[model samples]
Target: MDNYARLKQVWIAVIYLLLLAIIIPWYWPEEDVRQFYGFPIWALLSLSGLFLTSCFTAWVCLGREVTKE
Candidate 1:
């Protein structure tokens, strides 16, 4: 993959992390809603999103190579 495309992926990773970080902290502590499998519902959802996004990013970054035109 070209360096430019790789750089874009780094930006994407940063954006995703920033978004998740902002949202998880903002939403997790509100209302004290019950726990799912030992975690608040919001926390669980955030965690799931993080995990899935990681898997997807790895799949996109490693499973396929981007070529410059």
Candidate 2:
């Protein structure tokens, strides 16, 4: 696979794992959920990364199978 293809695969895998983490609860000490810039830590990071990866995958797929005139 070419560089773009490899990178795309890595990103797709990472996003899938992140989604799994988000959905499945894990062990965490009871504490107030901290907010950074008014965003929850887990929500901010996981969701943002998930969105970024999705957009990137879409862009790559668009280039792979279609052309714009």
Candidate 3:
């Protein structure tokens, strides 16, 4: 519908995807020992990207305004 609504939908989808990534091992398996900075590679990268993407999306969405203030 509107930019604000579209942004909210994107935000919700991203959050759901992030939750799925956290609960389900998409790239890395349970027995894998590969680590990045002492943390699981998949876990670290997936979460960091998720957080950063969410923040960036929010910031950009905030910048788009239909109302004059």
Candidate 4:
């Protein structure tokens, strides 16, 4: 409920928004066909983005301090 906490939350939200943007393949060309390890290139990128988002969320959750009010 303090300024620092609010700022931190805003930064976290911005990062999450960026990650969400990366997870979507809107930038990939529709006609392009490429595969890596049996998976499409876009699919691979999206999956990796999801993985990074998950890791970031876990790190934020696990590293936060709990305060008793």
TM-score of each: 0.49, 0.45, 0.47, 0.87
Backbone clashes, each candidate? 0, 0, 0, 0
> Least lDDT summed over 10 consecutive residues: which range in candidate 2?
23-32
Candidate 1 local lDDT, 1-69, one digit each (tens): 999979988988787777577446674556687887787777777777778777767866797767799
lDDT of 4 at 19: 95
Worst 10 residues of 4 by lDDT: 31-40
Q: List ranges where model 3 is wrong by over 4 Å.
A: 1-24
On lDDT, the candidate that comes out on top is 4
lDDT of each: 0.74, 0.69, 0.74, 0.95
Give the per-residue lDDT digits (tens) of candidate 2, residues 1-69: 899979978987887677667644364335758889997676666677677667766876676765589
Best-fitting candidate, scored by TM-score: 4
For model 2, the superposed segments whose C-alpha errors exceed 4 Å read: 1-32, 65-69
Error of 2 at 14 (Å): 6.1
Which clashing pairs does model 1 show? none
Per-residue lDDT of candidate 4, residues 1-69 (tens digit)? 999999999999999999999899999999979999889999999999999999999999999999999
Off by over 4 Å in 1: 1-29, 66-69
Q: Is candidate 1 or candidate 3 better by TM-score?
A: 1
Candidate 2 global TM-score:
0.45
